[model samples]
Target: MELKSHSPFIKWTVRLLKKALYIITPILVVSILVTVSYLKQTSEVISKSQNEAIWFVLQLTKEYSEFIYQLQSYQLGTSDYNDMLIQYEILWSRFNTIVNNSLVEHLHQFEGSITEIDHHFTYIKAMEEQLLQLPRTKNESSLLLLFKNDYDDLQIYLNHKFRLSSDDLGNKINAVSTLEIIFRYLLISTILTGMIIAYLLLRESRYHHRLAMFDSLTGIRNRLWLNKKLDKLAKNNQAFNFYLIDLDGFKKINDTQGHHTGDIFLRHVASRLRQLEQPHCFSARMGGDEFAVIELIQLNTSGATPSLLPGKLVSLLNSSTMISGKSLTISASIGISQFPTFAKSIPEVLKQADFAMYEVKQQGKNGAAYFKPYSVSTMKNNPLSSVS
Candidate 1:
């Protein structure tokens, strides 16, 4: 029995799939990691910006309120003019801080907010001298009223800007969250797809292994399996008898009944051989209409000896089978060879079995023979030697 190699196309396809898996797996992992890292960084930046904007606006509003409180206290004669001026200076410094601050500058870019704040600063600077001379002016109340109106306007502007900034930040956070969800699902899908591909590849590999070791048409162990078993038994120095069975008149059946019926007949034959399988015996399809069986020879324990297997196989194969509504009768010529006895090597054992089977074919069509060294001389006399 000889083992056949896989087709070139099959080999190439498997290699290509393996390479694709190797390449795609790492890329998928990297893509998932990068996407997650980017999302995290973006979220952190947005959060920091939100916090800074909120803190800046709150502090500015608080300083403006304190300045107004000081001015009112001075008008009521409860605080000195120096205190009011000091609060005004503090408010002016807050405006200057907004101008120099990077985060505030970024916020100002959103809606020309920088221009609006600059206008307010210019108006405050124009009123500064009058505000300083407020205690001696006769119309101090009117000036105070005007100043309060301006303060209200500034408060309104700051509130509006804060709301806008909050809404914008909220929208960005929502967008980022959506993107994160999409990326997560994409990552999961990619992982699942990779698993499925890996599972399919594993299944395909197992199928190829089965094809290499078993006969497809007969659904039985193949020549490669038989060869492996022979090697193992030979290595262990186990005494066993190898039987090579060839169907007689199989070609005539194929010629008369077509190949389809012949295939059905062969399957039936293989099924019969399967019945011989046990702990001590194994059967395999050797190719075409040839089959082989190995039976371990136990000299002490015996219900049926190894020598009786050939006769049993001959009887089993001789039984008539119904195929394509026709009764097809076939017989077998079995050749017997012993391991580590008459033959020491695998090739020699197979050759001796083949010779003995051919000798059976020579002696009429349906019989069995044991291999003997002297039988080699009778090979030239048999005309049917080259038929198979």
Candidate 2:
């Protein structure tokens, strides 16, 4: 069977689900964006640092060759000796940056490579000293050539070692990439699970809310909801009539026919009350074998009596009910209490109505009466049987 779309709980659940989704969606999106941004930044930093270290090693051989060319130019009187001195200072600064300033230089393998570079620099410095002393040596060109060749071989060896280290960095980046993918999937899954939980909690909250307002057995408004309506009307200063009803001989019915039949009878009473399609009329099953109602009274200029709704209600209760194909007649004792006419407070009105209904019971069942402030003696003696 197709379900009706008029369920308040389902409507509320959908509203709550949408609200939760709205709250969490942006947070999850931002979190993933931040994570991806951080990963990209880390990758860029690692790549930049590794490339810088490799470039420094590669530049060393070129710097040495430049120094030799500058020296030859000085011998030929085409370059000043000051130019060669500046080149030497620049080369030494580059070497210091590779040895001490680079982040990758702290590794054990890098330390050995640095030591070898230092040894090579020491031999180069010794050759520069010898060339300075013998300014016009006949074999200067051949000696410079041999020095350049040895330094070129050292540069090639350092490049190979740096390539191996760079390969390791590549492997680490690959691992980080894998972890990033896995983390992204897990975050998405967690977000989905959280949404599911929110939906379930919304459903639970709606169920509890319904339980709080409606009667569990007869599906009418319960005592708590009825009390709330009474308080609201009293606070608003609206004139209304309150009715308190008690099922007469309900105990006898339960004893003879069992509690299950008693339950069915109560449901039947609730159904009859629900059929009253009057404006500003509300009915509630206060508890077992007892009910209450509130009907707003619109007074005319001629001042006709307040609606005789309570009398009609009592008549309905006195009608026969068909239970399991057997005609069973039930009667109710009803009491009337009017707002502002009797008292203003909701509790006082309820108390007066209850007393009037008890008076009906005193005069026998199947009747209704208006509340009157009877003395304690009169209450004991049924001297005032003002039933209508």
Candidate 2 local Cα displacement, residue 383, angstroms: 23
lDDT of 1 by residue, 176-219 (tens): 88878878886887888688687868867776887888898887
lDDT of the candidates, in the order given: 0.77, 0.72
- Top candidate by TM-score: 1
**Predicted candidate 2: what Cα RMSD to the true structure?**
9.2
Per-residue lDDT tens digits for candidate 2, residues 80-119, read 7678668767776666665566564433234367777777
Inter-residue clash pairs, candidate 2: none
RMSD of each: 7.6, 9.2
* Candidate 2 Cα lDDT to native: 0.72
Each model's total of backbone clashes:
0, 0
The regions of model 2 sitting more than 4 angstroms off are 1-76, 80-202, 277-279, 298-305, 359-364, 372-388
